[model samples]
Structures are given as structure tokens and as C-alpha cells.
Target: MENDVLRNIALSYSPMIDRNRAVVATRLTVSALRTGGPLQADQLLAAIAEVWPEGGTRVSLNVMSETLLNDLLRAKPLSNVMIEIPSFIACDPVNTDAILQLQGNTLLLHGRPPSMLPRELLPRFKYSIVDLADDRRRNEVAGQAEAAGVTRSVGFVQSGVRTTAEMEASFGRGAVAILGWPIEDVVSQSGGRAGQPDMAVLVELIRRVDDAEDVDKLDAVLKRDPTLAFQLLRYINSPAFGLSVEISSFRHAIMLLGYKRLKRWLALLLATASKDVNMRPVMFASVRRGLFMEQLVANSGDEEMRGEVFICGVFSLLDRLFNKPFDELLKTIPVPERVYQALVESAGPYHPYLELTKAVETETAPVINEYAETLLMSLLEVNRAVLGTLTMAAQLE
Candidate 1:
């Protein structure tokens, strides 16, 4: 089939764990059809399956034509699929009756106030995507959802930008899930302060680890913090590592991971020390990006280039991690110019790898295809790499 429709496809994840406590619901946004357009059902379903291989994708069809809408409503493909319709459709008694007849199907109401949804039909769907963008509007809708006894959730589809405090507030106001906005982007940098003893030690340790080639020195430095040592040991021994025999000693860890991988882990450890809920999704994204980049390089028969690209992928989010400018932070660390240029200027050789990695995250199929072709890859290759990265990330989590 032609891949035209897939070009406008983008995936947004639910930031919070769902009611059933699933990891996250990957929401598929059909940008082309969002504003109303002609889309064949086959192409549309294929695109959804491609992005969300596992079922349970949340899709909103506010702009779909009545014919296509009724087709999906009749078929009832997957119970895991949450079908969202606008208030205009729900206001129709016949349409509402037909939707409620679907066996155990989940529904969401969008494009109207929660108060506008018929009270009789409120129990048919699972939750409402409340537009809590403004302070006054948020409080109002939140109360409406509350009175209707519907779970309140806000999506950043229209909201400009939300802060960590605001997300926490929404969660407090009974937001079961947050859509679109990345929580990491809005977290305050006040979590870090200059000249603080613990902060200084972590920074110093990251710097020292980057410079350390001596095994004894590396082991001693890691031993300085029992918590760090334990975390490292736990990670290396996890099933994700796939070690035939468990590694029990620092010497074994050094032998297995090597100095380069060791330093990379230390950097990531420092980057992810915060227990902030917002940071988890960002960290996962960073790790997934790095894995995606590393896999691409690995397939290109560039053995030595693997580590550099992996580092590029992993540390690409230092700006968010340390809550400082990447270049300013790079000054304190000893990253090679190749990695720095790729990250900061996007002009280096490895820069294409980083760009392709990001393209996998947010770009359309045509754009991703162009990047893949430039990298001597096919769509199948990119898809396999993405699957590998997602699998690895799940294990690490």
C-alpha cells in the first residue's frame, strides 16, 4: 500500500500510568485527518497498527466524516482502542445510543466542555479530555468532570505549556492521564544549586569517571557511594544485560562493561538521580533515542563509531537533565568535539545519526524515509531498530 497517509502520523504518549496501571498508552494522532479530510479505512488502520503494534491505542476522531465514523463504530475493532467523538455527535440521541451499544468499548469526549456531555451518556465512556489550559477554565472543567463523576484528564493539544507544578496540580485535581505535553520540558531547574556539597560531589564524580582509565581508580570512586555501587551492580545483573553468569565483583563489571560503557552509565546515573515523576518519561525517551542511534551505527559496519553515536544519543538531553545549557555544561565535561558538534551545531558527521534518531520520534514517514535513505537504510531497517530500542528500554525500566 502507498505510504502517503502514514506521513502525517505522530505518536504521543500518556504521561501518567492508566487506570489499569499499564505502562503508557501510545496515542496515535492523524494530523492529516485532524482537520477533516478523506481517508480510506484500510490505510488509516494500517498506519495505526504500524505505530501501535500492540493494541490499546487512544485515537480521537473529532473531524472524521460521518460515513467513516459509522464504519469504525460498527466494526468495533479493538476494545483496547479508545474511540473519542466530539460533543456534537454525543448530543445526537441516536449516535449516543449506537456508541453505548458497543460491547465494553472505551470512549472519550472531546471538542466540548465536560458539562455539555449528556449526564445519561457520561457513564458510557471512560474519561473526559478536559481543557484545563487556563487557571479559571481548568478549575471550572475539573469541577464539571467531578460533578459528572467522570475521571478528569487534560491534554496539551491546545494548552500552550504546562509546568511540573501545574501537572502535579492536575493530578491532584483527579487527572488520571495527561496527554501531549512533556512533563520534563517544564520541570524547574531549582532542583540544582551551585556550591552545594552533594551537588558538587555528583558533578565531580561525573568528571572524574569520564577521565578515569584506571580500573582501581574507577572501582574506588564507585565504591565511595554504596548506593551508586548497588545500583550499578543491580543494573549489570538485570536480565537486560543477558549475562550467562552473574557479575559479582567490581573487577568483573569493569571487565564486562569496559571503561567507555562504565563512564556512559555513570553519566546517565548522574543525569537520572532525581526521583521526579516527570523525569522518568524524559529519561526513557533519551535512552530510547540513544539505543536507536547506536543500533543504526551498529548496522552500518562501523564498530568503533558505535560508542560515539551511543554517547551522542544518550547525552543529547543534557540540557533537560542538568537544567543548564548543553554547551555550558559541556565545558565542565570532557566530551570529544565530534559529539559536541553533532549535539550543539548539528554539523558533525555523527549529527545525521542524531537527527535520524529524533526523526523516528516525531517526524513523518516521508521525512523519516529521506533520512533513512541518506543513512543507507530502509523503512524495515528503521522499524526493526525502533522495535529493538523499545524492547531494550522496557527491560531497563
Candidate 2:
């Protein structure tokens, strides 16, 4: 059922960042629910549980039918799930009765609780998700939960928080978490090469790939960094790789996957090599970006082009990771001309694809629609890529 309905849905996500800039949760947005069909609450949440089992996934949704709300309750013991209901739904006597039957940390109030709510029902909501993008909504809902005699188990979580200042402001106003990427906060706090001791090994390995060195040589380079070798082997062996035989060694993986594919994985590994806890979400986004980029060109029948785009997507965040401009870094680590051009020059054949990839992350329809039009891509293609890569990302993780 999850598979049957997933095709009609395009899933996008943002990490719920905490005061320490750690990704404490993930906020998943479904691009189409009502348009696709009646939202299948159970299948949707079941899929989420499988995708992010560590929990703390705030399922950003609004108003569900009585049957759908009942289905959500049956999705009990979803220990990591948090379903947001607009005030209209949460405050309704009928809905409130059903919501009280919900198990785990499953309810999040998307707006301020009306004074009409019975006082005891307030605590059922784990946290109030206030949208920072709306000044009136934030002003109305942000800090008034306490005053309303609402006892949110976890403080308010500010949604639409896109910048560092917003994060600071959200925390200052007593938000337990902010919904969205803390890219600026992560970049500002990143230690770059100073923190990532494996940078030298990764650089050398990448250089060997660029020079088209033999597998034996690449194997030797990987030997120098056991941690890097282990990371690669783990990914190859993961169910996502879809390999029959377990890849027990780096040499074996290289021989099996070939340089072109191996290079893509290496790029993913490099972008995610940072040890900073705050960078976890960035790493999460990089994997999806790389996979989405590859899927965009999946039918192009140009394997080389697909791999190049994948690297471009992954390396999109290298500047933030290494704390160096693309101009300086591209000189040392060789990338495809398309990738280099897109990242450093921001204008090339691949540039449009990169723009589309970033726009997909925004999860804003108009922005995505504009980019898709620029590249002559249909929304269906875009949705397929988004959903496919997210599923792949789930298996990869």
C-alpha cells in the first residue's frame, strides 16, 4: 500500500534543528495529497516510519477526514511520528475526542489553541508548530501557548525558519526546535579541514579517480584511511546498493561498481565526511541531491552525464563543508567540467539542473515549476525523481 500510493506523492523534508544546531527531528512535506487521492494516513506514516525509524519526524499535514483521522490513530506506537493539525481540527470537539486517543508523541498544533479547548486536552499536543514565515501567525501563536494554559511537552517549534537570525530569534522566544535547515548555522560553526582529519585521504583518492588510476592504486590510497574504506564498504553493502554478494573490501567494491559509479559514491562520502553533529542534516540533503540529480538524467542513456550530475549535486555543498570557496577547492580536487562549471561558474549545461535541484529542496511549487519549465521537464518527471531518490536515500541511510 505504501508503494502503491508513494508514486502519486512527492516527499520533501527539512531537519528540525535545535539550539545546539543539532538536527533533532525531520519535517517531511508531501507535495500532493488531496490532488493525488484521499490521503492514506496509515500508509503514508508507515512509509515515514520505515524511512526515518530513529523517530522525531513531524508529519506536516493539515485537516484529515474523520476516516483518515481514525486511520492515523490506528498508526499507534509510531513513536517518532508527529502529525500537525490546524487549529480548526485540533479544537473541534469531535476531532479532539479522536486526537486524545492518539498514542506516542503524535500530535502537533499548527496554530494557537482556541480558548474553547477543554483545558485537559491541551497537553495532548507534544509541541505547537508556529510558522515563522507568517508574522501574524507567529506573533499570534508563538509565545501564547503558555498563557493559554497549554502545556506543550516540548516547547514550540518554529516552522519556516530559513536563516541563522531566525533560529536565534526562535530560541530566544523559547522554541525547543526550529523547522528547516540550519545551513548558515552549520557553516558558521563548521571546523572544515581542521575537524575532518580524513580530508587528505579523500583528496588523494579523488585525485586518483580524476587521473583514472588503476583499481590497485585506488585500493592502496584507500588503505591509508581505514575509516574511509569502512564507510565506502558499508554503503556498498547496504541494501540500497542492491548487490547480491556482500562487498567485503574496497578493492572488491571498486571492481564491482566501476570507477564512474564508485566516483559518485566517493563524492557522497566526501560531502558527508564532516564530524560535526550539526552537519548531519547537510549530509542528509547531499545524498538526496546527488540521487535526484542522477535520476533527472536516468533516461538520457548517457551514464557519464548521469554520474557527473550526481557529483555536481553532492559537491554543491563542498564550500560549506570545507569552508573554502569553490574556486579554490576545484583547483585541488578535479571534477567534471559540467560539475566544475555549475559549482564555480554557476553557468553551464548542468547549471539549470543544479538550479532545479536546489529549487526542489525549497519544496515551493512555483519555484520548482519555474525551474522545471526552464529545463523542459514535466512535473511528473520531477515528482518521480523526488520520490525515487527519497526512497533510495532511506535505504542508503
Candidate 3:
């Protein structure tokens, strides 16, 4: 009856016999058992088997305790499982042996004062250290673990000299180094003061691109920024919108491509934007709006004007980044009159498409539907065009 009840709950979340279901059922069963229930070992094992048929026989040793632990170890349902061993629990030799009996793939060593895992048990388990103080301890513990034939995957809680060195050393040793925050975050917080040379080189490259009148100088400048160079080459080589022959160098590209194309490429490069979680949604929204507007204009007998319309859409969100009015920011760029008018006052011939794009960005679906009907366009057709443009942009990126 208890098995039936547990199986019912498991089926409620998922009916498939897969890893996801096994994880979910394990969690659910553990939760139920923890809440003062005197469940039998066989019952728990049976529940696990029902959820994870393949994984039932190789259950990891360190995953359970007391009767449940014994049951899982006996079952041997899964080959490997990640087990977390608290310092206090690891101090007990009996508990350590119990955990080793299960033969887990990775042992997550938690708590402080790394001496808890007995010397005898160290040789048997492939372990990764977690929650170590600074980088010094991380390296020391990793070194000790490696000496014991355990892979030293270290976790650094706080940033310090030791932590940085440990990360580098671990990489040297081919061990996984998990950073708390992204490296970019560390750079930003450090005021970019540490990497002045790299930044100086980038700024110099940008300046060269800005000042270059001839293709040779521009090509030389582009070589400095590989990312920018690749993007430029991609833009020039794109078939739907690019030239027929592949240009050999950046200089060739600049000379063959007019000023307008150069300016667009530069604008995209300048936007070397970070993909922060908060800004990602907004950036995607802007890209979608731009592509939608371009498609609308393309279908309106102005296919050549799609690029200009796309720019207006992309620049629409510039206000969010600069914290200024959109029209005020337009003065800096050499955009077309139609783009300026649509963005600033919605006065240009492309204003309706721009407005429709904005409506889509804001999720004012009814407005887009009404506008599409009035313009004698199918909503599905517009959606497909917008999606196609978005896919193209993603591929280019």
C-alpha cells in the first residue's frame, strides 16, 4: 500500500522511466521518509527501483544512511552517484566504510578542517573538495587528495592569491576548477586596473579602425581584434546580404564595402556588450523588434530599405543603456533620415512598422494583430519573417 502511494506520487510528477524521474522520485521518497515515518529499507529500495529501473541495482554507497544506506549498497543499482559527506559524518570510520561500499563516482567533501576523511578511506574514493577557505587551502587539500590518488577538484569560496594560483595549478593538473563568479565579474570589480595592457591594445585597435582612410590600415587594425575581424568577414561573406566574392583582407572589405556598411559593422563591434542576465532579455527584445520591423518594410515593396529599418529597431533600446531620450542619442550616429524620423517622432514612411515592432516588444499582441489586419498581412506570415530574421542574427553572432 505504501509502495502504491509512493508510486502514485511519482507518477503524478512524471510517468517516464528516465534519469529525471529517478532523481525526482528519490527526492520525494527521501522527503517523505525524513518526516518521522518508519519506512522499511525494502520499501524505499522498491520505490527507487520502480522509478529508476536501470539505476536500481547500482545505488551509490554514500547516498543513504542506516537501513536505507545498507539496502542501497546491497542493491548496487547504479554504478556512480555524487555523495556529500559532512565533516562530522566523515570523521566516523564506520560511516566512511559504509559510504565507500557504495562506490560513488564523485564525493563532495563539505564542512571545515579537511582531516575528517580518514587516511585509509582516501585511496578508495574519487573526491572533489568543496567550501574551502581562500585558494591556499584549496591547493593544499587538492594536493593532499591527489597524493591519496583522489582527483583534486577544488572549490574556492573567496577570491585570493591562493585561490587564483590553485585554479591555475588545477588547470595545469587537468583538474576541474569551478569559479564562484565569472572571470568577467572579477575583472569589472577590479576596476579593470589589473589588465591595462589588454584594454590599451583594444582601445588602440578601435582608434586605428576609426582613423583608417585606406583598406590596408583598416585590415591591419582589424587583425588586432580577432572577434571584430571575424564578424566583419562574416558580414561581408553572408549570401542573403553579402558580396559574391570572398575578400582576402579587411582592407579589401573596407574599400569594396561603402561607408554605410563600415559604419554598421563598427556600430555592432562597439556594442561588444556583455551578456548579463538582466540585459539579455532586453537585448533579445530589441533584436526581435528590429527584425520584425525590417520584415514588415521588406514586404511593403521596400526590400532594399530593410537594413535601415533594422537599425532603427536595434537603436530603439539605446535609451535604456544611455539613460537619455532616444532622439537625443541619435545625434551621435550618421543614421539615415527615415531611421531618425521613425525613432524620434514616428514621422517617417517606416514609422508604422517601427510602431508595430514596439507593440510586439511590449507584448501588446492585440495592437500587432489589428495593425497586421489593417495592413492586409497575415499574422502568421509576419511571425515567420520575424523568427527567420532572429535566427539569421543568432547564426551571425
Look at candidate 3 and tell me the lDDT of residue 294.
68
Q: What is the TM-score of each candidate against the true structure?
A: 0.69, 0.79, 0.43
What's the alpha carbon RMSD for model 2? 4.7
- What would the per-residue lDDT of candidate 3 be over residues 1-397, giving only the tens digit for each residue? 5343232111101000121111111111121212234434566445444433554322222233344444543444434333445556666665766667656444545345445567766655454433334334434554575677864434322212122333344444443333221222222232323123333343444455445456675566556657667765775576535467887666776678755556555544333333333233334445555656666766565544866777777667655544446677665555678888877887877777776765543334457666666667665455545445544544454
Q: Evaluate residue 151 in candidate 3 and report its C-alpha lDDT on the 0 to 100 scale.
A: 46
Q: Write the per-residue lDDT of candidate 2 for residues 159-260, one digit (tens) a residue.
A: 877656677777877888887765765677655653455777888888898777988888888888899998988888888778899988887877788777
Give candidate 2's TM-score.
Answer: 0.79
**Whole-model alpha-carbon lDDT for candidate 1:** 0.59
What is the Cα-based lDDT of residue 244 in candidate 2?
A: 95
Candidate 1, run of 10 with poorest lDDT: 12-21
Which lDDT tens digits does candidate 1 get at residues 1-397? 4544333333222233432223365443333323235445455555555444445344443324565566566664455556766667777766766777766666776656534666768777666555565434454654686587765433323222244555556666555665544545444633633333333445666676676657777666666667767776776776656779888877787788776776666555555555555665556657776767777766674655776777778788767766778778788866768889987787788887787776655535456667777878755566556645655655566
Question: What overall lDDT goes with each candidate model?
Answer: 0.59, 0.73, 0.47
Candidate with more favorable, higher TM-score: 1 or 3: 1
- TM-score of model 3 vs. true structure: 0.43
Clashes of each: 0, 0, 12
Evaluate residue 136 in candidate 3 and report its C-alpha lDDT on the 0 to 100 scale.
43
